[model samples]
Target: MSKELEKQGWVKRTTIDEPRLSEIVSEYKSLGYEVHLEPVHLEDVDAQCKKCYENQSDKIKTVYVRKRKQA
Candidate 1:
């Protein structure tokens, strides 16, 4: 019984959003398997992400989801 609570053996780990994680865990459990969730510390988030800088375009102005940018 105590062995069930032990954190040992293989696990699949990924940083997914909460909603998606819940969906995946629930889906797995529905198929009848124990799901173990553990937090992973992502300590090295890039402060100067060059990819982000490259992908971001100049901000576009819009209004009412179709109108125009406000002055």
Candidate 2:
């Protein structure tokens, strides 16, 4: 599992994996960066990809992950 944040107008990237993802989010938030996370299902993969591309192009960063769905 991994999480990435794309800041507005930044071409470079920062990647974080499980355990670290949570830590990074907290760190970024403490630094005053707005952060969000959404559970992504396999069925919604395409939509999620599109969203990441569009939003990221506009300076919004996103993290992609394949997590087991909760029962």
Candidate 3:
């Protein structure tokens, strides 16, 4: 999975020890998309984005922009 991302210049095949992150990468690869897992701190505002993405909710399905400042 990581190899495919590297091939597409989306991400480098470096050591990723996190199991969940690796799983996400593998899933995206299986779907034929080049993706790199972006590290997110749970305490930050982007954590909400991560949660929304995980839940697959329609509320967050529309175009949403993340603010630079953490709320």
RMSD of each: 18.9, 13.9, 14.9
lDDT of 1 at 35: 65
- Across 1-71, the per-residue lDDT of candidate 2 in tens digits comes to 23243333222224334566677667766665555554433343466565554433433234432222346
Candidate that would win on TM-score: 1
Alpha-carbon shift of residue 13 in model 2 (angstroms): 4.2
RMSD of 2: 13.9
Q: Mind giving the per-residue lDDT tens digits that candidate 3 earns over 1-71?
A: 33553455554333233455556556656656555444323333356456645443322212111212234
* Superposition error at 39 for model 2 (Å): 11
Query: RMSD (Cα, Å) of candidate 1?
Result: 18.9
Q: What local lDDT score does residue 65 receive in model 3, on the 0 to 100 scale? A: 17
Worst 10 residues of 3 by lDDT: 58-67
Q: After best superposition, candidate 3 residue 22: deviation in angstroms?
A: 0.3
Off by over 4 Å in 2: 1-13, 36-71
lDDT of each: 0.40, 0.44, 0.41
By lDDT, the better pick of 2 and 3 is: 2
Better of 1 and 2 by TM-score: 1
